[model samples]
Target: MSTLLLSQDQVKELFTMKDIVEICEKTFQGFGEGTVINPTKVNLDLGETAAFPPYKGFMNAMPAYIGWTDIAGIKWAGGNLGERKRLGLPYVTSLIMLIDPKVGNFIAVMDGAFITNMRTGAQTAVALKYIFNNGSSEKKPIKLGLYGAGMQGHTQTLAISELFDIEEVRVYDVMKAAAEKYKKDMKDVVKGEIVVCDTPKEAAKGDAIVCVTQSKDKFLLDKWVKPGTVIFPMGSYQECDDAMLMNADKIIVDHIGQCLHRGALAELSEQGKITEDDIFGTIGELAAGKLSVGDYSDGKIVCIPIGTGAMDIAVASIAYKKAKEKGIGGTYSFV
Candidate 1:
């Protein structure tokens, strides 16, 4: 038995933003139509795991099976909150395994960190399609405000820029050097000017806001963002405040059960600040036009899509297919 092994760089080489976006769109439609079987993630407190000593982190297992695509997989990731700055390592690292359900064979082993970053960003773009430009109609050029200049931020920028026609990308990070580096690295490549912002609020001023921070506390003020701005609060809602979630004109979640368990709504659910009724609908519903949200071109909206397993599986399937065509990655006998 042979399983293809893909590194982070190989995954990056195999994945294109446009293709990833298409995969996400198709997978989301499948989700709405009940053609997929992706359930809520199972989170483990890594601190409680039997390590040499107590650790300070979390690990999660996300499993899914897309019957229509005949794809089954699980993605597992673990990381500490401040490990990146303190340990000089990635905050979150992950791996995924694809299986042929009929034979129960481990088909491939690939780095999930890159896939997670890209697919999460692609999911945000999918939500944006329905929120900002429903029916795929072109709207005015967008001015994008971005928070956090980490790897996830880079993926978010790359994914959104590839899919949307943005005029400017104003980025903010507590570390000035990081934001500067993001600008320096991305300015030449993207169509828009990459501007470094002095504050998170500065970065939050635009037609759309994307918060990619890994911070645990809420740093964003509700007043900072403009009315009718589409926001993607996707980093476990760590960067969001109560007002941002409470005041949004519309809210979409990737999955309601998943959200309630390990999503932006978890905290809100605890505080009695929100209920399922407050949610607009899942992104799947919006993508399938099952919801009756009209003229979303001018509304303050937010989507909280906790990264789902099926999204990763669908995208990895695409990448695997592409790699087969392009002869990418490495393979060796596992049996």
Candidate 2:
């Protein structure tokens, strides 16, 4: 069989946020029940070395075998720290490969950067589904708070809007221009007001706050986060400070193993401030009813979904299928 090759633009044409979220729910639910096969992601830090410069960024290899669809694949992605500074490129750049489980043949090649961002955003939506109301549904107008305005931030906003009726979006970025641009661009798409805030504290005052920055230092402080707020820290690390994790009443993660190794809660785990016991459970558990997503009505909660490979492949699988059905993407035979 010939393989399908999909570009970023083609994937975008075939991908739907609502469908992506639904597809993610099945994979995530299976993962919680120990049915889906998703190994802990591998990370390579290329810092301060002869082969690479220091503090730029590293690469990650995330592979998964999603049972529901019977597709196995891996996402080979990396961050080029110098590109943003010297070449005006985003730190992240990557692609994904989808294989046919029946024949063990490589079946597709697709741009992973967009897939990654969309899945990451969908995870946040999925987390909110489980954590927002104990696996129930919410219909109230959402007051959204944001900490970053880059590509990830934009996609997160897009995904959340698909799930909730966001009446207002309060955002803050270190670069004022980025924040302004995010608002200007979102105005036409966002039904509600997109307000720019001067500080992270101002941005954190929403019912649902999402932090999707490349921050190496913690910018969000606990003093700004009020009770009954649900925080989604999407950055790999150090977007929400230690105080939030320490003070949160309940903590939910997409994958406990992955989050412990890196991402929002890794530093907190390393510092001994937060432990495995403190974690409530994976978002999937909450969705699958295996673990309790008790009411956070009177308490503060945090969800850190450190981007799982299963979700990545799940979305890619959808793109591949849709592209095939719609006669999209290029065809190649390497057999």
lDDT of 1 by residue, 1-335 (tens): 88888899999997678788888888888888888889888988765334634566788899999766787999998667544548788877899989888998888889998888788888887877777777474534677888888887787777776567778998999899999999888775457688898977778877778888766678878888777788877776447788888988888888888887555667888777888889889888878778745654545787787889999988887777788789998998878
Model 2 residue 126 distance off true place after TM-score fit, in angstroms: 1.6
Q: What lDDT would each prediction earn against the true structure?
A: 0.80, 0.83
lDDT of 2 by residue, 46-159 (tens): 661226557666778999998888899999887766645588776778889999988899999999988887888788877777777556566546788988898877878777
For candidate 2, the C-alpha RMSD (Å) to the true structure equals 2.0
**Clashing residue pairs for model 1:** none
Model 1: residues with Cα > 4 Å off, grouped in runs: 48-53, 82-87, 137-140, 296-299, 330-335
Residue 210, candidate 1: alpha-carbon lDDT: 86
Alpha-carbon TM-score of each model against the true structure? 0.90, 0.93
The best candidate by lDDT is 2
